[model samples]
Target chain A: MTVNRQIHLVSRPQGEPSAANFKLVEAAVPALTEGQVLVRNHYLSLDPYMRGRMNEGKSYAAPQPLDAVMIGGTVGEVVDSKNDHFKVGDKVVGMGGWQEYQLVDANQRGVLQKVDTTHIPLSAYLGAVGMPGVTGWYGLVKIIDPKPGETVVVSAASGAVGGAVGQLAKARGARAVGLAGGPDKCRQVVEELGFDACIDYKQHPDVKSLSTALKEACPKGIDGYFENVGGIILDAVMLRANAFSRIAMCGMISGYNGEPIPMQYPQLILSNRMKIEGFIVSEHMEVWPEALKELGTLVATGKFKYRETVADGIASAPEAFLGLLKGKNFGKQLVKLI
Target chain B: MTVNRQIHLVSRPQGEPSAANFKLVEAAVPALTEGQVLVRNHYLSLDPYMRGRMNEGKSYAAPQPLDAVMIGGTVGEVVDSKNDHFKVGDKVVGMGGWQEYQLVDANQRGVLQKVDTTHIPLSAYLGAVGMPGVTGWYGLVKIIDPKPGETVVVSAASGAVGGAVGQLAKARGARAVGLAGGPDKCRQVVEELGFDACIDYKQHPDVKSLSTALKEACPKGIDGYFENVGGIILDAVMLRANAFSRIAMCGMISGYNGEPIPMQYPQLILSNRMKIEGFIVSEHMEVWPEALKELGTLVATGKFKYRETVADGIASAPEAFLGLLKGKNFGKQLVKLI
Candidate 1:
């Protein structure tokens, strides 16, 4: 029998999570059920949303109970299969939790096709080719529905979701502007992602200056605002949104770190005649096949690219997750297991 | 030449306007130029939005400059006509400012139809049958699209716009809840306006209690929200919005008194996967005829009713406007010159 080392939730976090919030424990792996497959986790995804799950509060998803295993998505290989769908040797991705080994239902796992790594790395599936990639694409194309000549602004532009959104907007012939925390990320967004302009939000002292820069970048004002960091940036953008502006509310990373909620700019909204919509990727699962197909082709042809900040070992997962919340991760933060 | 007495903006108000901010100036009426018709103001419309125009700040409309006649919509009689569209003795509605007499372009005025005041008061055209009526109708039918059996919440529910919105939503078979400032207004909303429930926000003390009461009254979560007051109340309603909920942003009377903008519950927006849209009635002018035709029929059938709080004399217009901002006006606030 194989043993599984799992990171369990030791306590709920009041604000920012720490190493003490998690406890690593080992347990003997149970025999797989008739419809289950044994998976050895290769890469664990560490995202900002996990922080919300760690806290005991009302949110979109259920909070992680104390002493329960910390939940996450994992890219793994099928070590042994008791189900006909997944064979031993098949690579898969599923909600495998923060564990070295997990016995998951065959229906829960998505089979990953072996592709030529020369064109794109396998880790691209976790970044540009994965959930974050689909999130940005769907949020911009489906929710925002930006016109060709319209200006599109995205927060966290160098990160996984924002970078993809900016690139996708560019691909659709929309003028793309990005807001990033640092100069290097801003430069990368403009140079690498081919955004029209990038705003270094960290260097900008106030939202007023950010608004001025944003207005200068897009003289026509923002037509589509893909919001990832919702706080002062959102307030500033709302002030300058053009008539019929569409705002896609994806994530609010700025507020997730336990800051006071920002003031509602209902006046700006009423005056501008804007539409602000919130969306979750899982809600559009029916059309995801088509989206994934398009995204997969883009990555295969080198049209779309991504970056990964992979932390070594399961012990570093919490640190990586905290770093992602702090914007330390250049792209998608992942923990690799040997 | 008929001399016109105009209320001019002496100075912009810092927070709320007092009698000192306005100056009643009697000036000699200018000779009617080509294409200009001389008009005698009969009834002036006093609205809360006029408060924004009084200030020297960026808004949907240009600010009222110092010493300039305070801007407003008015029902006037054309004393002399230079343009072919209007003739002497024809009653019309135009942007005539707060004045006794003025020179206007014939192209700028809408010809008011002479109707029987016995059935429906002529002032109803300026109140429920005019801009406020269209504002509520369009915002409800087009923007919010309140579904049958769905719960709808309207802020400032006893006022001109909110009252009309609640009535329209009720007409559409939606469960309507009204949020008003006083117990009298709340009673009027439920009994007269036919709202399913009413919340007297003044007595509630805290928005959380109101929210709980609103949820208890709604049972089924709110699907549409017609917002006129944007403060903590909006934040509270946002928290109870269900998936695919639509918020039609009408006005923000709560913040109009120069109160600091209230904190937003943007996280609730994402969690609920909601949509909030802001619209101006002017943008939907093409569809106005359809809405007006329906509203006219409703008025004629006595299915939809309106109440006007007429503050007699042009001098009382500023006080009426101040009363509107303070939620003292039970229904549509109007200034009668006759």
Candidate 2:
């Protein structure tokens, strides 16, 4: 028997979650049954969607239950296995939660996938090459379906999903623009991510000024939009959108903190003849195999790239998540659980 | 030579349009050349969309040109025809402008169509069986596409498009609810138009109260919405939308007077995974024949009913249009100009 260190949600957050809401607990790892494989987690992904799960109200997915292990995506190695499929020393990715060890049934669907980490790092499985990357792929390819030469704008451009969106848009021959929080992140978006232009949202005081900035950045007017951060950014994009534009509503991290974020120009949706659709990637499992293959190839080649804001040890997850909610993390926020 | 009385837009209104903006001028009707037909106007249709055309800025359609005849939909008798397809006394519908006569070419697309008013009244081509009715059909059937047993809510319930939306939703076996200005209009929406319920927006005083009323009315939550009036009504509906709900944004008469209308819960759009699309029916001319056939059949069979608030002559059109924008007209507002 081995001792497993786990993080539990001690209390529900009122506004923004603090470290006090989470508790670190040590418990004995259960023995692997016949169909079970033991995974020793190496990294835990901290995402904006997790903040919504922490809330007590209804969102796209169910709220994360209190006093239970904090839910997350983890890339780990199969330490032990009684299952025929997964052998010891095999690397895999699964919903291993914020813990050092996860005992998952091999027969379950979407629980475990044997990950080949030869070309890319294992931590990439938790970010750009995984769910966040697939999210950008599915939203852009399926919903927006931008044509070549069309201008596409993405919010949170320096973050995992937005970075992927900008790079993918560029790969598809569309002019890509990004909206990031600060000057440094905006610079990274245009220079490192290869976006055509990046707008620093902090430089503009209000939506009107941001809209003016967007007008200057996207001279052709936005034909397609991949919305990650909502509120003023959404309103700004709407003001600058051309007729018959498409917007993919992926995440609204701005409103996740329980603040009322109003959209000022819904009439533009009618005047511009636009279509806005909100989607969750996990609910669409059919796209995963195709998306994962494309994402894996992009990451394997130097064409697709990403950065990680890594926190050492599982105990730092709560503070790291808090930082992400405040837009402190530059890219994919991850906690090194090993 | 026949004398034609025409209503010309003398000046653009700063805010809500008034009578001084229009001028009635008498001129000789142009002789019908080869392939042209001279139409004597019978009825002019006044709609909320015309208000958008009056503005100086860009809308879906071109702005109403200064000092020209006010653009509108008209059902008139073809007084003289140089084209082989038309004959004198034959009723036709076209964008005839606010004039007593119109000389149009037969080969011109969207110019004129020979309308059979044998089963339905000639004016029905302007209301339930016409442009307003087709607007509702395209918005509900094409965009919302609510399934049987789903609930659909329409704002401006007593208006032309809203009434059609409620009737069409009922025909498709869905529960139809409405939002109208006063108790009288609300009663007419439920009793005359066959909606399941009608909420009087005036009684509520604010969006929060209206939202509470919507919660009580739509116990299953709004699965589909036909947005005709924006502002508080849209805000109320968003708070009560179920997961994966569809909204067809047809009009926003509430904002036509230039008030800034903000949507309070755009986050619900993400949380509920909803889709909202804004479209113009004229741009989609392919769906007209099918939509008109269905609308005509329903109106002829009395399954679809409509009311008209008629203004006496071309002289009363400007006042009637101003009143229609203010939600003072109970149904399809028209000007009788025989």
Candidate 3:
């Protein structure tokens, strides 16, 4: 019998999560039933969204259960199966949680989707061609709906979702501007990600200073914005937005740790006549096939270039997740449990 | 020749507009050339949007120019016409400003349009069948787009746009709820305007109390909110909003006069997955014909009822407008000039 190592949420954090909040454990893999599949998870995605799930307060999602396997997205190959669909050595993507192995009921349709890892890497399914990529596609195509020659701005430009948003906007013929925390991330956003311009937000402290930088970068004013980090960045976007702009509110990672992030200039929404919409990517399942097709083509053809930071094992997930919240991880933060 | 008595913006208001900000002056009506028409203004509309025009700050529209005739909507009779489309005794509505007589060059296509007041009264054209009515229609229909059986709420519920919004939502088979300033207005909203429920916002001091009242009134939670008053009312609506609720941000009248109205809980937008869009009514001319047809039919058939608080003469416009800002004037505030 295989011993499956896993991470569990030991406790909920008040402000910021630490190592004390997670516990690593080992459990023997249960024998697969007639319609069951055993997936040995290769890569586990550590996302900013996981932080919101850690808080006990009423949030976008239900709080991550204490003393349980930390809910997560995983891409791996099936090591054992007693099911008709999933066979041994078949690669698949599923919500395998923070564990070395997942016992999935293959009878469930959407629970497991077999992915072809010939041209695309197995880890890419957890980044560019997966949930994060689909999020970017939805915000750009459905919400922002940028036209050719329009200026599109995105926060957290080095991150998986933000990078995809900027690149996709560029593909639509819009001038894509990215806001990244450090000079290194800004370099990656501009040179690596193919954005028209990348603003190093670390140079500016407040809304006024950042707005000046944004104004220089987007002389015609911003037509669309895909927001990841809120607070000062959102305020700057509001100040510099063109009339009739659209803002896709994705995440407020800056204030996710029990901080009050009030929108300072909501009147600008009226003055600029903006459409600000917040959405969950999972709720919009209809667009996944199309978004994935586009994203898959982009990655397979080498049009979509992404960076990844991989931690060693399932035990490293907590530290890696904390780093993601602090903008420490350069790109898509993942735990390589293989 | 007729003497045109006009009110000019003598000075911009610091907090609120007082009599000192406006100057009542008389000028000789300009002589008409070919394709020119002289309109003897009957009713000068005193709307909340006009208050926004009184400020010198960079706002939705261009700042109401210093020492110029105050911009307004007017419904009146044509005394003389040199145009092919118009004749003497034609009832028309146009941007006539704060003046008794207007010399309009009829060649300007959209500056003037004739209205039939056979069943619908001339003053009704300024309220229920005019810009205010269309403002409600566009916000509710285009932005909110409330589904049947869903609960739709409107702030400033006794006012022109708010009243129309509630009635229109009801027309679409949705439960219409309202937030008015006082007991009298709340009573009018429920009894006269036919809202499902009405909450007297004056009874509640802050967001918590108002939100409690809103929760009780909308037990099913708010599916859509048409915001006219901002600050406390907007905060209350945000607290009581359901998942995937849509907020049509029409006006922030409460904070129009240089007060900061920051959004308190933008996190709720992400949690609730809300869509908040701000718009100016005039910018959407395509929906005017459809909106007017619906409103006109409702008013003509006696299915829709409206109240008017008319201040006598063009000189009364400034005080009437100031009263509107304070929520003192009920229903469609107008200045009757004959």
Candidate 4:
């Protein structure tokens, strides 16, 4: 039996998660039952939603159970299988979590899928053509519904989801604007990703100053917004939104630290006739096939650009997740676990 | 020629408007030209939107021009007409301002219209069967779109718009709940209007307490909300909202006083996946004909109920309007100006 190195949640986090809250453990791989496949995970996806799972409360999904393997998306090769549908040495993408190996039942729908990484890189399954990419597409096409020539804004502009949102907005013939944490990310967002303009939010500490910057960037006014980082960024956007605007509330990364951050100018939602909606991509599984097909085509054709911040091993996942919550990671954060 | 007594806006209000800001003047009626009709105003509508117009800044429409007759809706009798569409003794509704007489041109399509009040009460055209009623119907039908067995909440429940909203919500097979200022209004909202429950906001004094009451009233959670009075009441509704809730923001009477009131817990808009939208009734003229037909039928058949708080003369408009901002006037506040 092979040894499986795994990361587990030792305790629920009170505020920002600490190194003490996670543990790295090694265990023998259990024999797979009928209709099951054993996956040897090569890469584990780390995202901001993990912070909410670490807490003992209900958010979009249930809180992570203590002492359980930390939940995540993974791309790997199937080392062994007991089911007739699968064989050894097959590559797959599944919710194998933050572990060296995972036992996935073939009958369980949406838990496992075959992947062809000949034209596309394996890591792209967890970033550009995966969950984050689908999230951006869902918000942009279904909720934001940007019209031609309308200005669309995305927060956390250089990150995986925001990058996809900007590119998708531009693809629809809309003016795409971005808001990023620092100058470097802003430059990458505007120059590399083809966004019309990018506002470096770090230069403006308060919402008032940021609003001024936003006004100068979006002279015609924001018609659609993909909100990733909430707090002052959302407040600033509220001040500049045009009549009948739509906002897709994707994530509130700033308030994931258990702080009660209040939203200001909600009355603006009324004043501007804005429509804001929160959604979970997992619950909307019906659109994944269509989204992934489009995303895969875009990435393969070099029309879509993406970047990754890869940690060395499985043990680095806790630290990488901590860095992600603090906005330390420049792009999609991942653990190259083997 | 008959003399016209008019109340003109002497100055734009800095905050809540006062009697000093209006000047009453008696002037000779202008002679009718081609397509012009002479209207002797009978009832002048005193609405909350007038307060927004009294300010120098914009809301939905342009600010009421300073030193001009206060913009209002009126039901009147056409004393004389040069137009073929209207004749003497015909009862009509028009945008006649705060004046005892108005010269209306028939060519202005939306400005004037003849009404058949033989079965329906004439004054109902300005309240339950007019702009306020249409406002309620549009918000509920177009935005809220409540499903059967869902709970619907309305703020300012005893007023014209809120009353229509609750009645219409119940008509759609949903349980209607209300929030009003005092015990009397709350009683009327529940007892007279057939709401499932009514909470007196004056007793709660804060959002936390009111939210507790809302939880008890709406065991299924609020599926739809008709926002009329914004402030603590809006905050309370936000806390009790369920996933995928919808809010139709018709008015924010509390903010009309010019004090910058911040909305609390706007994150609920994201957490609950709620959709909130602000709208102007006049902008959506396509729905008017269908809405009027339904409202007229409901009122004529006694299936729909309404109450009126009538002030004696056109001069009482300012005081009645002041009372409205303070939540003193119940139902639709109108002036009997004949």
For every candidate, C-alpha RMSD to the true structure in Å: 3.0, 1.5, 1.1, 1.3
What tens digits encode model 1's per-residue C-alpha lDDT throughout B1-338?
46678888898888878889988888998888888788788888888788877877677778888998898877867788788877888777766788888687666545333334556556777778788999999889998898899988989889888888989998889999999888888899988989889988886667688778778878898899998888878877887888889999978776765787655677677778888888878778898788888887788789996778888887887787877888888888888876
Docking class of 4: medium
Give the per-residue lDDT digits (tens) of candidate 4, residues A257-322. 766667777667766777888877877889999999999999999999888999989999999989
lDDT comparison, 2 vs 3, better candidate = 3
Better of 2 and 3 by TM-score: 3
Best lDDT goes to which candidate?
3
lDDT of 3 at A29: 95
What are the runs in model 1 whose C-alpha is more than 4 Å off? A107-121, A208-220, A264-266, B27-40, B76-84, B87-91, B107-120, B212-216
lDDT of 3 by residue, A1-338 (tens): 78999999999887878899999999999987889999999999988889889888676678898999999999999998999888999999999999999999999889999999988999999999999999999999999999999999999999999999999999999999999989999999999999999999999999999999999999999999999988989999999999999999899888888788889988888888999999999999999999999999999999998999999988888888888888999889999998
- The DockQ scores of all candidates, in the order shown, are 0.59, 0.83, 0.81, 0.62
Determine which window of 10 residues in candidate 2 chain B has minimal summed lDDT. Answer: B109-118
TM-scores, all candidates, are 0.91, 0.97, 0.99, 0.98
Cα misplacement distance, residue A316 of candidate 1 (Å): 2.8
**Clashing pairs for predicted structure model 4, backbone only:** none
The digit string of per-residue lDDT tens for model 1 on A148-182 reads 99999999998889988988898888999999989
Candidate 4: where is the Cα deviation over 4 Å?
none
**TM-score of the second chain of model 2 compared to its true counterpart:** 0.98
Q: List the residue pairs that clash in candidate 1.
A: none
DockQ of 3: 0.81
For model 3, residues B200-278, the per-residue Cα lDDT tens digits are 9889998899999999999999999998888988889999899999999999887877788999888788889999999
Off by over 4 Å in 2: none
What is the C-alpha lDDT profile of model 2 across A162-214, one tens digit per residue? Answer: 99898889989999999998999998998888999999899987889999999
Model 2 lDDT per residue over B227-287, tens place: 9988988988998999999999989888887889988888887889999999998888889
